[model samples]
Target chain A: MLSKAVQKYCVDTLCIFAVFLFTTNVLAHGGATIENDRCVFRSQGYSIHFTAYQPSFSRTKELCRVVNSLSETIIVLDFVDEALRKLPVDLILKKQKDDQLYADYMLVDERIYPAGTMQLPMKKIEQGSYRLYVNIQELAHQHEVAENVHQIAGFFEFTVTDGAKEKDQSFLARSTWLFYLLALGIFIYLMALKYRS
Target chain B: MLNANVIKKLVLSFVLLTISTVLYAHGERNQEPFLRMKTLHWYDVEWSVKNEGTLKVNEEMTMKGRVHFFSRWPQVISKPDTVFLSVGTPGPVFIRKFSYLNEVPMIQSTGVETGKSYDFEVILKARLPGRHHVHPMFNVESAGGLVGPGIWVNIEGNADDFVYGVETRTGQTIENLGTYATANVYKWHAIWAAIAVLWLLWWIRRPLLIQRYLLVKDGQWSTLITLTDKKLAATMIIGIIGLLIYANGVTKEEYRYTIPLQGGKAEVDAVLNPDEGKVYVKNKKAEYYLPGRSVIIDAEITNNHNLPIQLGEFTSANLRFINHHVPAAVAALDEDYPDELVADSTLVVDDLRPIMPGETRRLHIDATDAAWEVERLSSLLNDPDSSYGALLFFYDSNGKRFISEIYGQILPTFVD
Candidate 1:
């Protein structure tokens, strides 16, 4: 009977561990997949190559979504299509709080970029979850004029944190601690049962 | 005489070897996303392989494309001050006959300006027999190789039967440049390998390390090297020098009219303006229906030309979707071109009527195909920014073609 109970306990623990592993795997590969070896952000029939850099903190490294440092962040959107250069586009930076979005920064006004490149220098941004939206001004105008027409735009989500310290508080990091505690608890319970026997 | 375990192990070994031989070609997806996206954007790439399904030895293929040096080049990589255009293939599988960028020969590295597109063409001849993936690539000065779309080509026949012949400027015909001086290379390598083996054996035959250290500690290190060893070393050094002098004399006598390899970049003229037709296309809205596997784009097209025009083709990321109704676009597909990239279903226009001269009309274009999903381009719907870009070709009544660019956000609809 004792051996059967131990087997049941082992199976239960393994099942829980599997669930944890599966959830973390999904989270890691959740947003923004690489296509043709490129991190492309598509806006209605057009695409832009999105890249971020924290030059003051990590000059040589190219960042995608996470900004490790609180320093001035440089975000560059490269137009993959020449047609995008002719359209007027704007960008908005918003922060998420309690499922509500609040505008944090007006990164760009509606303007045509002839060079096919838009560089946004962000400073004084607090640590939080933020969304950067690229709005095509022409499409936005059409949306306003027509009812039931959605605005044509694209957006990417990123998290700003206190570098390594905040990274340790992430779900994956905290789950690691939980995993160790669970294992230790199991080991201690087994030792107690062995002593009683 | 073999046991059951031995037979099992043999079977396992065979399976492993068979699996290893089924390797995939082109590891382009292994590169960092930033480098592939923000560096050089390749567009309108067209590859033509002669006898594509089974190209015989010595047959030729061509890859032509346009590469736009992205203006927003990544800061992590150095600027492409000097770039060399080359072909990417499994080592020496195909020999590059000629490579031209903007009609100028790309024998050496050349500087390119950002925000400009350069037309390039590369001709390659099959050398090895097997399946190979070929890509048009550019090697930046500091940055590594930036590759374009890769196409798989199959070569049949024996590799040994392949020959590359060339005619020198002095009107001398070299029978096979590929095998030229091959025997001399093997002879020199054998001679050097023999000398190295003799030298290694001479040292290995002697009591090494501890024995020599003990002699040194006893102040009898001089005994470690006998007079015979010194004489043999001197003789070996003299023999090497003599061989070098003899080889130099033989080479000078055999190739008296040798010319040094040409260096310096060839001057290429500025990129010519592509003849974009007077037709203009404005994207009203676009959506991709998931269940139907189709992309529906609504746009307003204006015809400024004197003749009425009809939509001919929609091309994106080297994939061509032709309008079957337009004979001109369908005729453009070469017989040797890969059929997998072309959509089986023709592009559908809501209104088949051609827009008259000086008339603007709203057109709904439906590009439906399993190719969108097969090419993995439909994954754009899952991307954070779901936008797409495509070139629309308009053909006039006289078969004159005009090009217009269309770009807009594409939303995915679950319900068709």
Candidate 2:
């Protein structure tokens, strides 16, 4: 037979676990999606350009056709130095029509540009690492409240190594091994503690 | 021996006293309407005090009450509407070690709707020892708003002298706030903790061991030592309770510095009144080199208030346009207005000129649009639908200041 103290301990443990699980569930989300496919990030001396394409598209014409197939999109650009939060700069570009240029209201960059290839100067970029995130949401062009679907276009990581050496550039660098090692260490430590306790 | 009835009465009285004192303090603070209205109002504030490891410690934080939008009156919103979580530390002191907004790293900025409730959380590391008032700060659609000014936090130690270290796999070490340091706070805490546990174990078990050794041999000895055992248990319970309370207070003082953030909604009303004189903002030209040209605004000020007042300062959001007649320097666009386009509002042409009663004076303002070159991305004309905001500050014969905010399209007429 279970003693009163043992039963009480079990009940209390269950209560605490239930509270934790409920809290975690309340904080979950579907995901973060991009609103526009076109965007830009400008620092002091250079500008970063971003473009999104369907994996199925192999040629520039196919990419252009895919771009035309979409109705609405949102692009968010985030800028950061080595260790600080900074504002994301928006870019505006124009797209070319059939022998005529028209302002595509729905397909413009943050600066409201038309659908077409645009070039930005390096002078607009500040000296740091930057991320340009483009989220493409295509709503059914016919309906007012069409179901919107999206895809995450991968980001490009680059450094503004103007007059500076690559080794000296202290921006976003690929060092996943470090994070992986830390995770592994934590896993082992937790396992050891679990068994010991 | 204390009977169950006596024990029950003592516990009940202690609970009543604690509850009543807490309620009375809250009641006294809620009496003043201005303090109730203007003071920092906090809601859904969560604070967690943790050890060196990311272990769960104490996670209890309360928002004293709900917040109300200050200066929600129409016709004046110098700063665009924004809500932010503010804590009283120099700035991002903990480096945010690890944080979440609705479980995301993003800072919470959902506009406060009146009477709507929201919860906030902050994970604070063991930093400086001091008691500080941290409040949730919000930037409303206009001039100034701070719900609670400060939280009386009693901190006993300095943060600069504090340190925590994390041992990494590659023999590398990471310090709290990502700063590199050799001091390890964890080692010190571990040593102190070992001592505390040992002391508690000795006191609790020492009496039981003696009773087992001597009293087990005779029934008389066991009966004689019953009082001693009861006294030992009581003393241990009291000591543990005292330690728990002391530890909680020290955790708040030494490690946990809460940012008492304020939350609430504001209502805005804008209408044209005949009696209220209209302020015209006109410029000969609108476009200029973001760094080169200046756009001058001329304002005709008329004091409607019976008493004379002086215009103290003109501030919008994070931009202080005019302060005490002296104009602030033109800051970098990204640094000043992170969310919106920055308009040059430094009144360099004329500084701190006063307007008397029943008199209208022309105020000239030269806003230098800094030089910014746009690389046209295959476009013939620039987009005209860009969002631009304008604001004006006026002071009457009295020290009271009135503000007028304008929102319209800024048509940049290009001159080649």
Best by TM-score: 1
Give per-residue CA lDDT, model 1, range B103-131, as digits (tens): 88898888887656799999989999998
- Write down the worst ten-residue block by lDDT for model 1 chain A: A28-37
- What DockQ would candidate 2 receive versus the native complex? 0.02
lDDT (tens digit, per residue) of candidate 2 on B1-416: 99644554565556444433212112212222222222223432222321111211222232222233323222323333455544444444332333333343325444444322234444444354444444444444444444332233333445565555665555555564345522435754775688678667755765666676677677656465467667877786797788768767866875353565645432322222342343333322333211122333444556555654344333222223443252222211123122111323334445455555566666555443111111121111132333223345555543343444433333332121
Chain B TM-score against the true chain B, each candidate: 0.68, 0.31
- The two-chain DockQ for each candidate, comma-separated, is 0.02, 0.02
Please tell me how candidate 2 rates in CAPRI terms.
incorrect
Summarize candidate 2's per-residue lDDT along A1-197 as a digit string, tens digits. 45554444444434443455454432321111111112333233223334322222221111211232221222222221111112222433333345654332222344321211222322132333333333322233422221342222433433232333433545435466677557755764554454345
TM-score, candidate 1, is: 0.53
Query: Residue by residue across A153-186, what tens digits does model 1's lDDT show?
Result: 6677777877757556779765787888778678
Residue B127 in model 1: lDDT: 90
